[model samples]
Target: MNILVTGGAGYVGSKLVPKLLEKGFHVRVLDWFLFDDNIFKDLKTDKLELIKGDLRNSSIIKKCMQGIDIVIHLGCLSNDPSCDLDEELTKSINLDAGINIIKEAKKNKVTRFINASSASVYGIKDENNVTESSKLEPITLYAKYKADLEEFLHSQASEDFSPVSLRPATVCGYAPRLRLDLTVNILTYHAVTNNKIVVYGGEQKRPNIHIDDLVNIYLLLIDAPKEKIHNQVFNAGFQNYKVIEIANLIKSVLGPDKIKIQITEDNDHRSYHISSEKIKNTFNFSSQFDIKDAVLDLAKAFENDLVKNPNDSKYRNVKHILENEDFINNKILG
Candidate 1:
């Protein structure tokens, strides 16, 4: 099997590519290598190929689509603030470029196209546990783009070509491209390094999954029955907890003396607790990592300085890096 993974040098991609190569799949990574190529430079796999190009480049995408069996589209203008930085660029990459990929993949007769969706699509709801059937109420540009593209991908799938969207929850786990911006990892890093955690909107409910579990779901969708995966969108969260609860859990792992929790009442337009019963039942998938383990592992990574000095820009400034034009341009071309 030959798989093309967009953003394959990223946090999830760096990890997923190795797994794919280990399982005997010839892997081709299409990435901008925004910060540097140093992140995946050490991957000593003979089957791994890197294509540094932009997604909007139809010519390059056409070349990538040739003879590829599966398309794992993980490249995008992720996060609300980043989209807000440049809406036109975000739409082009997140929505327009994605449609182009689908069109070219279908033309190339690609077997499977797995889209990386987000739970943010179900925006600002007070519901306890949201399901796949729930109506979308996207409050951010990032969420809106995800929801719109999901519909677009579903409408484009045929019998021979399958398209599935995994609305993964807030992913937390150690990776070659470690991200300190995520809630779990950020809190753990702060606890381990700074001995402090300042939180806001403690009442907000959010669902989460380990980065390891999230990537496994991508692999699972590949071999899942056609009737089971085609045009199907499933929430990919393992557990749910209030914001305060999560902070307390981090405190438990880092010890009371190592952390301080300060909460403020700030109502954000992004809040939704997701449910994963649909995917679990449909594909017989279950999460092996939980919050307790995630916290412990993240603390260990921080203590060892594994993610301390990243070679790439994605883990640089969680805020600035996400909203950087240089990063977006790199993703488009790679």
Candidate 2:
């Protein structure tokens, strides 16, 4: 089987492309390679094909679709702050481009199309557990784009073509293209290096999934029956905890001497805990890693200086990305 993976140079996509190759699928990766193609440099195999291009170009997308039976769409301007750059650009890339990919995949007679959706669609609710059936309240343009894409995908699912949307929780842990901007990774990095974790909205509940487990969830969906995943949306996460609780968990795992915690009352627009029961029931999938493991592992990576530099642009925060789209787009040196 041949598969096309969009955003194949991304944190999740970098890891996922290798996994697909291991399963004996012919993998064609369409990525902008903003950081560097070095992320997949070690992945040498006859079955693997690398196409460096942006998803916004229909011609490039069409070229990547040739002989591809499955399209795992993971490309987008991720997160709320980044999408706020220009609503027109966000909708064009995240929503409109995504819809076009589905339409193109159908036109090419692709067997399956798997879309990566965000858990942020739940918005800032005071709920203990939000499910796939939960009413979506998307405040950010990013979330609205994803929600709109979900609606469009549902309309495209039919007997002939299948589309599955996987709503993964906030991902932690490291990858080839590392990301330190995420809550768990950020807190752990500061805890060990600076000896303090200053956090806001300590009581806000959030759902999380380790990077390893998140990749496994995607692999599971790729192989599951069309009847099982077609036209379905599943929330992907292992556990939920308050923002402060996550800090404490990291401190506990890495030892108190390694970290200190400081909490603030500032409440960000993002706050919600999600339930993964629907996915567990449907795919027999459960998260095998937790915050403690992620925290400890990231701390070790920091001590060893595993990922070149912690402040590297590729691993930088969303705020940094939004302000310097040129830095990201041009891959400038720091």
Model 2 over residues 115-203: C-alpha lDDT tens digits? Answer: 99989887777777888989898888988989999899889888888888899889998777878778898888888878899889787
lDDT measured at residue 175 in model 2 versus the true structure, 0 to 100:
78
Instruction: Write down the lDDT of every candidate, Cα atoms only.
Output: 0.82, 0.82
Error of 2 at 168 (Å): 1.0
**Residue 108 in model 2: shift from native, Å?**
0.4
| TM-score of each prediction | 0.93, 0.94
Residue 66 displacement (Å), model 1: 1.2
Off by over 4 Å in 2: 317-334
Model 1, 1-334: lDDT tens per residue? 8999987887788779888888889988887765457777777987988998888889999999888999999987666776887778889988999999999999999979999989999886777789999999888899999999999999988889899998988888788777767888777777776778778887777789998898788889877878898888999998787778889999977797758898777866356788899998987888998888889888777678777564344574346455566764544443
Clash statistics: count for each candidate: 7, 0
